[model samples]
Target chain A: MADQLTDDQLADLFAGLRADTVAAVLPPGADAARHTVRRRRQARAAVTGGLAVAAVAGVVGVAVAGTPAAPPAEPTGPLPTADRSALRDLAESVLPPDARSAAAWSFSLGDETSNTAGELPAGSYRMVVACAGDGGTDVLVRWTPRGEDNLFDPERAVVVATGETACAAAPSPATLRFVTPRDGEVMVSVEAVDGAAGRAGFAYRIVPAR
Target chain B: MALTTDLHPPPETTRAVPDFDELYAAHYADLTVQLFAYFGDRQEAQDVVQEAFCRALARWSSVSRYDDPVAWVRRVAWNLAVSRWRRARTALGFLRRQRVAEPQVDGPSPERVALVRALATLPGVQRRAMVLHYLADLTVAEIAQREGVAEGTVKSWLHRGRAALAVQLRPTGTEVSRG
Candidate 1:
């Protein structure tokens, strides 16, 4: 009998089903509603943009991986070995005087295993650093500052073109600090060859002073 | 530099707009009910519908005059629900650990609840077609136009949706439950 019901009968059945009227919960005001809408729309836009950037990066990563390449050149200098403790120390030293350690970890170069230091609240500048030997090879530090709400910044120049370097000498060790001035929650990542990449980590808070 | 600039949300619109209060009064309850059926969660339904209305209010100057302003709200609300459904389910699982109270449920009959649950099990396309067809009173052609699908596809969805619903809603005994 249920299957035999005509379309009209089915429609009528649903239409006739009585439902309790939901109490009207009008928005605070039109202005407030407008702000809410604007914020949500902007958030959605950010997510969409972030996904697009991720896609581009993914494609670039694929293309780079596909091409045959020479092995990364060894740093022809009396540089310190890219060990964990040294990398951790170098990354930690760059923190602003007020910057408390939010989270920290070490990674071996070419491990391709990334670590998220931890989360930062909304509307914060996230400064990340990749510390390694002065191998002078390119290090890619990428991060997505994503909120608990999943909003993310995708367009940030996570890795400047391979040749565009941001390295600083740290005794025998060298560092690449990718200072991502951003808002909302974010995750950071660093990648390099087995010998060049060291540790990538970050610290952040809302209204982080410099 | 290009990436940093792109992160900034576009400038807000500044122009004459419609009377959002009046529009909200006209559409909020109905949109909420439609979405409640769509999501099988009244709180999520209301939240997404309210969000859609707020968005409509934001672009009232442009959206108010569309041939069907309500459709715009429904489309946005549905999209929001789909996106939220994935993330919210995961987040809610964690929130449940925190012992957050679930939203208050509107009273519904046992049969209706069963039916809605069955409806929820349908694929997204079929569910959307059925909701627009049965709840929203949208014609198959209208759904086709709105969803940017062929009319035949809409018809197929409605047919498949009905077939699945019939099995789910089929009677089990001599006692027939009235719709």
Candidate 2:
């Protein structure tokens, strides 16, 4: 019985248990070393750069030409479903698959400048922006197929963030988009243009599904 | 003043890196054995210890700088084992009553069973103190610091714990030996 064991005996017993515990804990092959990190990096880069753009456009703002030479995306296309939810989900996904959002927040951003850019956090952020009649019913069109600033606005939208360590919000030539490159998180702002007093809005957070 | 956003390497990267392979070779056997003592269930203890270490790897930067990295990991592993024990305790409340009172049970090897039985008898803090003290080769002062108690308190625990263990194994006080 351990109760009857001397301190020396118990110590020896404890030492013996330590050895057995570690061996039993690390079953053979239950290590990350077995997994291929090289392949993972490649796959990550693919989705990070290319797929991220397509996903972001499909998810956040409407693509508009940014050549600074190109004209405004004619407030033409029916303002992306006055309930613009696709755009919100897209913004949130800009974060690397790990950010969540607070109930509400406010950010200072641009609207009709033909682009959205900002240095925001890096995480999964659920962003939703409403240009409700602000700036006389503006259009949230992601005009071009690719998301580029020089092709649209050389300004390269900049987003400076302050909050959770990693808040990912990828920026575009137009409205700021969340980008999840690192694992940190942060909150940011996207000013609504011509927004009637309270219309120009943007929200984000690191919210992951799994 | 403008905020300084200088990006420095994480603490783990900054702290001395351990030779994982060497650590594995040198201490693997001993660490495994000690962890097993914490939880008589060999398989579960192994899993927790391994996972805890992997986590340590993942956050090596933060954990390496800790006052005692190895001790830090042991503590993490210990916490995980405790949580697992709590869960098992709740779920197996009924089955425990019978086997617990008996001199023996029908699971695991005899050595493992005996060790666990003995561990179950010690107070939670004492068990932890004993484990860290013996397994990590930490002294009473270090244990006191880690456990957030005075050296005197640790001595008391060691005294009481050894006495109880002595009675359990060496009923006649002939000093039951383990090695």
Candidate 3:
């Protein structure tokens, strides 16, 4: 019969278990790893830039648009519910031909509390924003269609831009003319004039300009 | 106001800052492996580690200056993994209740699967203590400090964890001998 296992034996057993962990997944080479790091850095910058844009725009919008733009009326449409993968596809579908995603976050709006000032009334929308700080040249912003309701109503589904500079082109419902300001960030605000219950929100990121 | 400083300014010692490239090269694989063992899922491990590294790179100038940069990354990665686990559990639980088939997660060795299954039987605290102790090879005091617990408590946990693991790992012949 075997005697009680010693601490050394126990440690050896644990070490053996570690050995059984199979081959460690090799990293995607040093160059790929470095690229990942850079991409991540840019994504962080984009998020920070988005926040900065929102802060600056909040101040500018009050000074420029006046009256907090009166939060859009909550929509009364039949909101669409989508899994994260569907939302991601929606975000990707609207990107400019050359744009690539860097990061993404999903959110729910029309709830009791407001997560962002740039929300639509009560329908689900995904905000896909990207940066051009690294080497790229434009930030892409897309909102998933809130579905049949007042989600796409021109007056209700309005997009507003506020910051150092206004949208380069005439502002459309979703155009902040991110291509206009070469350096500074701008907030791209969306709102549904009318709203209903159960709205979803998503944030998708794209690689910043190199 | 009187001048408070003399002519000498603080010395400029250029600390070696490992840029994103260097840092990723040095730590990514090891971190992924450690986290894989921590969570028993390779994809989740990789995702969380990548997210943590991204956060580190975002704050590189400051994060790189930490006493233990790897520890900073590991801590963030572990926290991210735990948060992901909580969210997935809730979401997947709902799916399970509705009879929906959840997505499959691949890439765990048979031994790893067994180990995780065995570890799951222990209390969460004991499981954490054992993994950090045996897998990470952290000393009792280090575990205590990391866990915000007393060293005596850590020792007790380690003792109990070892006893539980021994029973779980006992050879099949041992059961027959007792029988």
Top model by DockQ, which number? 2
Off by over 4 Å in 2: A1-5, A15-167, A171-210, B1-15, B24-29, B65-67, B92-112, B171-179
Score candidate 1 by TM-score against the native: 0.47
State the local distance difference test value for candidate 3.
0.45
Residue B121 deviation, candidate 2, in Å?
1.2
Best-to-worst order by lDDT is: 1, 3, 2
lDDT of 3 by residue, B122-156 (tens): 77668778777887777999888776689999999
Per-residue error (Å), model 3, residue B57: 1.7
lDDT of 2 by residue, B1-179 (tens): 01112111122335466654444445544555556655555555666666556545433433444544566556656655654565566676666565455553333445645666787688866766666677767799988877667999998887877777656655343654578
State residue A67's C-alpha deviation in candidate 3, in Å.
18
- Please give, for residues B1-179, the per-residue lDDT of candidate 1 as tens digits: 11111111223245444466877767776677677667776667778887777756644444554556678778768766765665456657576334324433545655656666777899978987888887787899998987668999999999998877776666554344469
DockQ of each: 0.09, 0.15, 0.07
Candidate 2 residue B95 Cα shift, in angstroms, is 7.0
Tell me the tens digit of each residue's lDDT in model 2 across A48-125: 111112232123422221111111111222234432443334433443333343323322222222223233233334
CA shift of B94, model 1, Å: 7.7
The prediction achieving the highest lDDT against the true structure is 1
Per-residue error at B155 for model 2, in Å? 1.0
Between candidates 2 and 3, name the one with more favorable DockQ: 2
User: Distance from true position, residue B172, model 3, in Å?
Assistant: 3.0
